[model samples]
Target: MTSLLSAQESGIVLGSPLFAHINPRQLPQLLTQMQASRRRYNQGDWILNEGDPCQAFGLILSGTVQVLRDDFMGYRSIINNLESGDLFAESYSLAPGRRLTVSAMAAAGETGILFLQQDFFTDREQISRGGQDSAQVRANLTAILATKNLFLNRKLSYLSQRSTRQKLIAYLSDQARACGSRRFEIPFNRQELADFLCVERSALSHELARMQQAGLLQTRRSYFELAEQLPETDSPI
Candidate 1:
């Protein structure tokens, strides 16, 4: 909705698109008076770990951060990627005593975030009085959660297939469906996609090339164009 964060900007503006739809106007004066800070995390820097106390919530003002969880065997799986303008730790912000269930880290370059504390949301009376605004905020939250659930369902479908090629194809097919077209742009690069898909970068590239050669898809950088059908013998997974 807003231009990606600028390299020259040191911090996020309160009125930025990152918070545009969050309905701060419904917050009380005390909450609206909350302070803000900019934090920088280097590549691979851990922002938070699972089971850690949720001290503050943040928004990604710049760069990319990956939300992931590690299994008992120490294998990590990415849950999602937060880009500029995306909110992070929202559930933590709302639920003070809750523990973080996943870890976050800067995927590349330095990540910049806008942090706010629980004190910023202290005035429940104001929120209650701002009836329509509060309703809008609740509606927005519900819609976002619904979208997230849909995304999770799609991810599950993508991962259920056994074939690596089928997995990639399934992901592309879902993306196409989400965009309501055969041609669509992917939000992640090869490395990020590999992480999202739990595959090696080179392996993803090879598979993508193979898919294109097989007439199942076409790509120019992050933009992919999918065919309505795969090769006759490939068989849908």
Candidate 2:
């Protein structure tokens, strides 16, 4: 991990949810207080591995972070993809003494992240982190954690779908909604998309082809456009 954050890097850190209401001038002192550092990784690099003791809360500073689960035979499943400004590992970090159940990996080039070493909300932790008490930062951290938890429940809903088409529709619809447009680019390619949906790669490809032919959606690589009237019937859980 790098000890210093460049001017541009400092802007990214200050703009993050965890630093909400914090002044730019106070960042260096705050980073020092929390024992946090910035780091960047190349594509496919491991940011956090499963079963490892979790001590820090990680925030994606740039590029993408793919949270993955592995099976006994080493097959991998994509739990979720987090983009720049997204937070990860907060749950474990807050609880303390818990090991990670999934791994976080770089999805593409130069994935940068910030790791803050203690529970942001705990009074003792706040005192230990230099007695710089800021209620705004604590409120911001609580809101961010709650938002992440809601998204996790949404992911669980997608994973429970019985069909590849159902899973694809559910996930894509949410992506479109998130972007506020019918057209949007997703973080995953075909294989990674299959892993995210917990479906076979071949099945996912075939289903996409069928959906395109049926005029339900049009996709090229990672970009997609959903028909105004989606074919999804079941309400999202």
Candidate 3:
């Protein structure tokens, strides 16, 4: 079977895990009644442009995409980096017709996405038929939103700190935990990491060199692995 068919046969339903925030029962109705398509994007392709109308809710099946915005002064700031199992194009769920404030682009690898039309989620009866208590539903949604808010806050905090060392340390620590592995690969390359962190590439490189010298981490091409004895504060859980 193809990957898509295998996924379906495995009973891997939509809106699970990352989207477990939504009621599971509602998910079947949400998916079956709505349209979904698997689309591919080559590396460096734009999935969405800034100011585009948010028309659908997207889920990342594989690969990485960076969310960024170009300022009036023509400087680009990366808001976030999304990887497999992440959700995107979520604005339509909150506010239809709202323009995407940031642009999304496939990063190093090809990306696969499944998107649902926004209007499909607006059916109150369908949403409510899941039989979850109002409080339970609100709590689930809150947890989902809270996870996103926390991630944003962490990114902001990292950017606010002085020195590339601090930012790099924070980023690596965050990634280690997110990947749930002591030895894990970063989702982006050095250049992409520098861009996402809003730092000069040369400066970031120097800091990374210093980090390697300090025996905190090791880099092999685009992948980084945390040395067994990273500084106490730098070690990921």
Candidate 4:
């Protein structure tokens, strides 16, 4: 565990969505009671490793982290990308003594994370005696978990497509709906996007070029515009 800064000294806005339901003035006390700590990670650092004991859950305060899973043969896949205010590993943390199934790595920038030990929330005495504060924290944790579950389900839907073009269309369509525009900037670049979609980079590039030439879409690096609607069938390259 890295040396941690006090919540106030860390400069994270307690009013962020993760803590929105709690009073800002009481954040410090809440953190103290929960035995939370703020830790920083440099670019490419591993914040959590697969098979490691998940004793705590983390909430991103700044920068980005990529959740990844690797098979026995060491083929890695990007599970998800988490940004500020996003929580990770809550399910594993809640299960006492369980090991993590995914590894979390800091993206290509500095990242700050707030970690709260599972025991802080699961201890029977604390839950029974701590009154409204503990209850609020538990409620917030439940809400966060529910939201993350929905996100994972959407990601699974995207990943389940059999064709690269279908995967691309599924991802782009979701992005369009999320931003409420036919044009939007995606977070991943070409190679990162390829890894995220679980496709060969060269194959993904070819598919993108084919789509652009067909007037289905226009893309410039991360920026994308849906020039025409995607087909209902899975279109393989």
Candidate 5:
């Protein structure tokens, strides 16, 4: 069963970008106004389903959330995998009549999410009454949405690659850049990586095995080492 947002978890939310410039002392009132509630989900539990009304903006307080989409044939693809401190559903929350196109599921044990209703941001009367806090949240929300757009572009860069090797190269190279090293551990497993890359698991595995044999890269599970040239992708086009 889910419980109330604890003091420590509230601190995490207050520290997030969406809550930037918000005063800690006044956050309780803002939470009350926004009708914020905390919920917990076990691994594999669906937190939000596709076609559902997207009325709340969610913040991950703990664990991982996998944003996924499924086709009519029930094939699932991972749109994004978010971890602690990441925000979700902000765009949907801001859209008056939007429904979610993707479902969010817990990808780790006991993921905790704090959901704040959309009315607090949309209510003109509330915004007028809210003073600086409301204005700051509005600014923060804009920043969050803008950041999400950049993230979308980054994901597109990976997906737009012509081949599985190219896609993996784009993604792993970026990951290495982010970690400031050619060696790092990725968050996704083989299957999750395949889903995120929109490729068949067998194909992904086969490609990785080929790359390994060719000495382009080395991998033991999720850990990888690019031996030279940021060219873990030199194995492919």
Candidate 6:
């Protein structure tokens, strides 16, 4: 685990939404009280595996984490991608026995995580005062969980589309709206995007080519530009 001093100096912890509601002056006390630990992970590192004991949840201070689930036969599906300021594994960490169903892996480059154990919230005497301090912590946790739930709902809406084209359109349209621009960069690469959309890479590539030819969009690696207005129905060609 990295030291608190280093985390503070790096600004990773201070910048994260997990600590956004915390007062700057109280940050040291909060960290010490929660026994928060910081750790670094390289690309492709498995931060947590399915069935692993989820004693704690982590906030991404930098870089990204890919949440994936694998079946009994070893087929894997990407559930979600989390970036800086996002929290992961809170639901599992708070549950009894605290066993995780999904695996979290480091993506892109080096990632920094601020881990807070379950006791951080449960042990009121240690981390929270009776009045405003306790209420603020609860508010922070509620906000995080609500945001995560909404993100999952959006992912589900994207995945529910029947065709590869529809999925692509849904994802791109959502991204454009989120970015407030027709031109944007997506976080996932070819294979990762294929996995994320639950489509075969070859099929997705073929669809992209078709869409480009149809004047739907243009793509160069992760960057994309919507060349024309999307159709009402994103049905398969």
Best by TM-score: 5
lDDT of each: 0.69, 0.82, 0.68, 0.81, 0.86, 0.81
Candidate 4, poorest ten consecutive residues by summed lDDT: 1-10
Model 4, residue 112: C-alpha shift (Å): 1.4
For model 4 the TM-score comes to: 0.90
| CA lDDT, candidate 6, residue 189 | 89
lDDT (10s digit) by residue, model 3, range 115-204 = 666544566765565344333433544566678887788888778767788787777877887888767786677777888889988898
- Per-residue lDDT tens digits for candidate 6, residues 1-237, read 134746543366666666665566676666676677888999999999998998888888888999999889766688888898788998898787868889999987999888888886776584545345445665788788898888778778778888999899989988998999999999888888988888889999999999999999999999999965896544222
TM-score-better candidate, 1 vs 2: 2
Q: Is candidate 1 or candidate 2 better by lDDT?
A: 2
TM-score of each: 0.70, 0.90, 0.74, 0.90, 0.92, 0.89
What would you estimate as the lDDT of candidate 1?
0.69
Model 1 TM-score on a 0 to 1 scale: 0.70
The candidate with the higher lDDT, 3 or 5, is: 5
| Winning model by lDDT | 5
Q: Please tell me which model should have the higher TM-score, number 3 or number 6.
A: 6
Pairs of residues clashing in candidate 3: none
Task: Write model 4 residue lDDT over 70-176, tens digit each, in one string.
Answer: 88976678888878777888899999778999999999688988898887779888788776656777887788788878877877777888899989998898899
Q: Which stretches of candidate 5 lie above 4 Å from their native place? A: 1-4, 231-237
Model 1 clashing residue pairs (backbone): none
Q: Order candidates by TM-score, high to low.
A: 5, 4, 2, 6, 3, 1
Cα error of candidate 1 at position 33, Å = 5.5
lDDT of 1 by residue, 137-228 (tens): 44654565576677777777767766668778878877787899999997787877776777777888998888889888899889998888
- Of candidate 1, the 10-residue stretch with the lowest lDDT total is 1-10
